[model samples]
Target: MINSRKTDHLEICAQKDVESGNPGFDCIELDARSNPGADFKAVDTSTKFLGKKFRFPLMFEAVSGGTRKAGEFNKSLASIAQEYGLGFGVGSQRAMIEDKSVADTFKVRDVAPDIFLVANIGAVQLNYGYGVEQCREAVESIEADALALHFNPLQEVFQPEGDTNFYDLTKKVNEVCRKLKVPVIAKGVGNGLNLADVEKLDVDAIDVGGVGGTSWAIIESGRSGNGCRLFDDFGVPTVECLLELGELGKPLIASGGVRSGVDAAKSIALGASLAGVALPLVKNYFSGGAKAVEKWLSQFMFEFKTSMFLTGSFKVEDLRGKVLL
Candidate 1:
């Protein structure tokens, strides 16, 4: 199921634009040439995440642990992330947990030993027997700096083998938060983050996986034989989610439909601590290889720096409050 589903996701992505509603990058207007005196070469593109500094405030986002191809992709991507000083997130380790033989597939520590690595897992899967112990094992297995708990109800409802009984999830989240040594990040997969939903969670951060980026509902429709077609477009756009959840004050990760460095810069300008992107890279990488992925990512950094320079925002951290119109 994991292998097939992973492939299905990629196929669907290649066929069409699977992004949810407008992620809201368009709504944000970057402040123009206000500081004509600010030197472009002096622009600083560095920022910190999970207590570590990264050259760019960009995340490869989670999409891992399924097939041999997925594993190979992860290994190469992890190396590039480490070489460039960016954060890397492994896909769900559920497959490894269910079968130890597949563990090596998600093992990226060897390639990106020092990068800020994040372990991935479905939060709702906790209600079915997952616990703090499993979460610990996941982090330990990946040598991860933090653990990201993904909330993907929309996608699951469309999956034939979906488990929608999310009962006791909040209880489990708080329990795990108390016991885990690392920070717990709350992420909504293509559904956007809700402060109310996480009010009870002792999360260290939140990824506004709002809509306007990969509409999982649509992706599942292709796999589930159109059963989920009715709700193809759902959830709050990424931009709206960010603006709404930014008030909560938790470290925000803008994912969903973040396409370019300009889009990433837009997210940071509107309170995102870091921006996350996955779909575009997955497509490009599949068509090319590691170099393709690197070239594309390097472009993000270039555009991000260009955006910073144009806005006269010299620092990545200060962009949140100073650059957005």
Candidate 2:
């Protein structure tokens, strides 16, 4: 059941019109300076997150796992992270936990031994009998450097077999954070995280899987026999999530609708430690494989660097306060 669901998700996201809302990047404009402090060739995009350094402040957000096809995607995407020195995340490992035979589908250390890999698990799984031990297995199985406890109530609300019991899940997440050896990140699906949604999480970082990107609600709705469209556009926008949580002082990963490298630069300037992309890359992979994905990433990095140079920001840190709403 889990394996089939995983495949369904991958196909729907790649082929369906699952995007909803806007990430609000259009509302922001970089304050280009007449004198860029550094030369374009020398601009630095490197940054550290979860105790690992990345050549670019970007992450290939959780996309797929738990099937032969997903495993192939994981191997390929992890290799991309290795090549670019970016972070990579695998989809929920519950399928592997339930059926260990499929665990190989989520393993990628052979191809990407050094990238900062994040193992994922639905936080609501806590209510369905998952515990800290399972969290440990998720991290150890994939040799992940961090763990993302993704909270997707909106998506679950639409899932046919969704576990909607998110009650007291925060306490459970806090427990896992206290016991897990690796860093924990509290994440959202496409609905983004508000201050109230994240204040209680004792996570090392937060990935505001904000709106303006793939709408899991819409994806599940496509899977649903009955079309549910009312809440398709719900959730906080990506930029709003960053603005709401910037005061927390916790590192933020702006995801949800991140498309181009310029959007990533805008995210960094708005207070995100890194930007994450999923649908765009997955679509690229489905259409043109690894080379096509690599080409897109290359262009993305160039755009990001150009954004920094235009703003006269020499390094990732200089992007702060470089945007005007």
Candidate 3:
């Protein structure tokens, strides 16, 4: 059942019109300078997260897994991360947890041994009998560098078999963060994370999978007979989330409608540690292949570097709180 859902999600996301909302990137523009006072050819986009250095502040966010075809996508995506020195995350591992035989579908250490790989699972699962043990297994089984406990109450509400029991989920997440050996990330599955909700999570980082990217509600609605269409545009925009969560003192990962390197640069300037791309990369992979994925990323980085240069920011760190409207 879980495996089937994974396939359904990948198919709908790749083939259907799943994206909605404005990530607010369109409103935020970089202060461009004709002569940046630095060499454009020497712009540096490298940064460190989870003690690993990324060639650029770009992460191939959690997109697929839990099936043979999904496994191929994971391998291809991870290889791209390895080649580019970026971060990679697999989709929810609930399928592997339910049936261990499918665990290989989420493992990519053989091909992406050096990149910062993140293992993912639904935080709501904690309310459904998943705890530290299961969380650890998800990480160790895949040799992941960190763990992203994704909160998807909105998507679950739309899912036909959704586990909407979010009662005291924060307490369980804190327990896992304390007990889990690897760094724990509190992630939102679209619909972004608010300040109040973020204060409750003792996570090491945050992936504001805000709206403006793939609408999980829309995806579930497609599977559940279009009942969730009303909430297709739900959640905070990615830019708003960054503005609200910038002072929390935790590394921020900006996702949801991050289409290009310029969007990525805006995110970094607003205090995001990394800019994540999911649906577009998924589409690129399906429509083309690994080479296509690589091509898209290459262009994204080019645009990001161009933004950095035009903004007079040499390194990724220089962009923090520097760019203006």
Candidate 4:
């Protein structure tokens, strides 16, 4: 059954802490200052998402698929996204499209052939209507350039085999973004996507996935034992869902409970063009594997270039509305 719920969500997100005791990194704090005169060797982490190009705006959130230890934990997280240029997501390929021998658990883009892959699914599998060529054959089985779609109705209304028929889900995600070919991100599994649901989604970008972090309704109500204490303090917090979808303009990521690099430069000064971590890189990709997941992602890209040279900012679009106070 979907590879036994993807090995029961990686054995309840690895032996149950069920993560969500408000991990929204204390709702934004990065008035970072040490030497604001800039030039930590001219900080430039590089960017440019959906249309490709990236050196770091960070994204490796989706965690695991149907089995074979999630295809060897996505080939050691696609060799740490090919030695840390970053970008790689693979978890919910709906049990490798309902069993294709778990499709190599989720072929990590045939081993990181130029990163920036992303193709997880489940907006109730597009309201269980699955068309648009089955979401374009799950984005050509993972030559994905974009296709996240997660949204978890509070972990499917407190799971017990949850699916609660969310009818017409935003016009079936704007008809899978008008017949998908690429681009469709509409995440939120930690329950954070507001500003009236991002002004009623058309879809292109938006991850939010907020609420501190890992509270898939306290990890599916602690794997169905269901002692719901308000799913251990509910959602919408990652810097107030990135200041309510960074006042609408679009392109947003800032996933839930981000771990560091100054919580990814305070999620790019609260207007995130990117930044989506997953449970401390799945506990450093299951303990020191791909060179300990590239030494914990090069220590969050050297604390995101020392918080962009102490916030005098040097790139990544000069960190948008640059304001770490």
Candidate 5:
């Protein structure tokens, strides 16, 4: 299941018609040329998350893990994160918990010992009998700086092996947040999050994995052979997700369909602390390797800086309030 699951996700992402919904980056308009005296060269894109600083507010997000190939991907992705001084997340460690032999696959500390690594788990797994101990081992296994609790009910219900038991999940999240010794990020997988949902979560951060990026529903449906194509346009776009989730006051990760540095800029402009990209990074890395990823990151940073400078945002914070044109 581990290998097949990883391969399935990669293949679906590589070939399937999976991306859906409006990521919402295009709707925003950045104001130009008002601050003629603003220093373009001094515009800073650095951001702080979970106490560590990154060169840019872009994270690789969670992609794949739990197999040898996944481990190799993690190693390469971690190298990219380390090179760019950005944050990174390893895919879920549930496989490792179920079978200890696969634990090494998620352990990337040897390669990214200093990067702000995040350990991942499916929150629904708690209902399947996983508890705080498994969460602890997941973090320890990777020396992770934070833990991400993924909430993918949309994908869950569609999955054949879905665990629909969400009973007492909030209590479980609170337990993990209290005992896990690191920050916990409440995340949605390509489905938008709102203020009410954010309020219900007892997490320190919220990753509004909105629609318009990679649609897990499409992937799951394609795998099931029946498809949920009609619902492919479901969920809120990343921009709206960030705008809505950003209001709840938890540190924000603007994910889902952030495709470029400008998209990341738009997210920060809407009050997100950082932005994450997963599918595009996966596809790009798969087709191009490390150099491609690095080139893309470099271009993203350039576009982001260009956005800020054009909008008179001299620092990352400057882009927060007055970015819209």
Candidate 6:
């Protein structure tokens, strides 16, 4: 059953038309003409997130947990994070938390000792009274710098064995944030958070896992054969979500449908501290191995640098509020 489940994720992630048609990048354009002689060499991609400095404004978004393959995948991801000097997030740790025997599946810190890592769990898991101890254990088990509570009720609702009890989820999340020693990030799973929601949350950062990339609804529908077309197009586009949350005065990480450095640059211009890519990285990791993944990430960072140069912005902070063409 576990093997088949992993295969299902692998297949759908690798071969499905999961990206939304109207990715938010269309709504934003950088004023590249403003800097005809911009120096690309001076562009700085450094960012301070959750009290730690990252050499690049990119994070390896969460991807796996539940099997031996997951362990191998995370190890490779950790190595890449260390090599590129970026942040990394693991997939939902619920499976491993429930059974210590599979703990190694979520253990990537053993590989990248100095890289910033974020431990993940579903917001719904907090309602079960998992408490600070469990949250700490997840982070300690990983030696993570932060904890990410993923909000994927839509995906959960679509999955056959998904959890339905979402009562007091925000309160539970707030409690978790208050209790945990490390920073807590409220992450959306391809259904980006709006400004209103962001204002009400107590998380230190927000991962706008917007629509346009890896539609969990479509992925879940594909896995279940439920044929719910309505869900296929749900969630805000990455650019739009970034714009909405840009004024919220908190660090934001952009995800979902962010394919290139331009996309990453657009995200930064729209107010994202970092841009994260998951499905593309996962596919590369599975097919071409670590070297393939490293090559892809290096290209992404290069693209971001190019965008920064074109905008005449030498630092990530300089990219903020810059006029969009």
Which candidate gets the maximum lDDT versus the true structure? 2
Ranking by lDDT: 2, 3, 5, 1, 6, 4
lDDT of 4 by residue, 196-291 (tens): 865787888888878876777767666777886765647678777777777777888888878888877878887888898887767666665567
Q: What TM-score against the true fold does each predicted structure earn? A: 0.96, 0.99, 0.98, 0.34, 0.96, 0.94
The parts of candidate 5 lying over 4 Å away from their true place are 34-36
Q: In model 4, what is the error at residue 38, expressed in angstroms?
A: 5.7
lDDT winner, 4 or 5:
5
Question: How many clashes in each structure?
Answer: 4, 0, 0, 4, 1, 1
Please give the TM-score that candidate 6 achieves against the real structure.
Answer: 0.94
Q: Across residues 142-206, which tens digit of lDDT does each residue of candidate 3 receive?
A: 99999999988898888878999999888999999999999999887779998999888899999
Model 3 TM-score on a 0 to 1 scale: 0.98
RMSD of 6: 1.8
Superposed Cα deviation of residue 254, candidate 2 (Å): 0.4
State the C-alpha lDDT per candidate. Answer: 0.84, 0.92, 0.90, 0.77, 0.84, 0.82
Error of 6 at 192 (Å): 1.1
Between which residue pairs do clashes occur in model 6?
Answer: 29-325
Against the true structure, candidate 5 reaches a TM-score of 0.96
Q: Tens digit of lDDT per residue, candidate 6, span 184-256?
A: 9989878777677667889899998988888878888888899878877687777777777777788899998
**lDDT at residue 162 of model 2 (Cα atoms):** 87
Candidate 1, after superposition: displacement of residue 118 in Å?
0.5
Each candidate: RMSD: 1.5, 0.8, 0.9, 17.9, 1.4, 1.8
Q: Candidate 2: RMSD over Cα atoms? A: 0.8
Q: What does the lDDT read for residue 268 in candidate 2?
A: 94
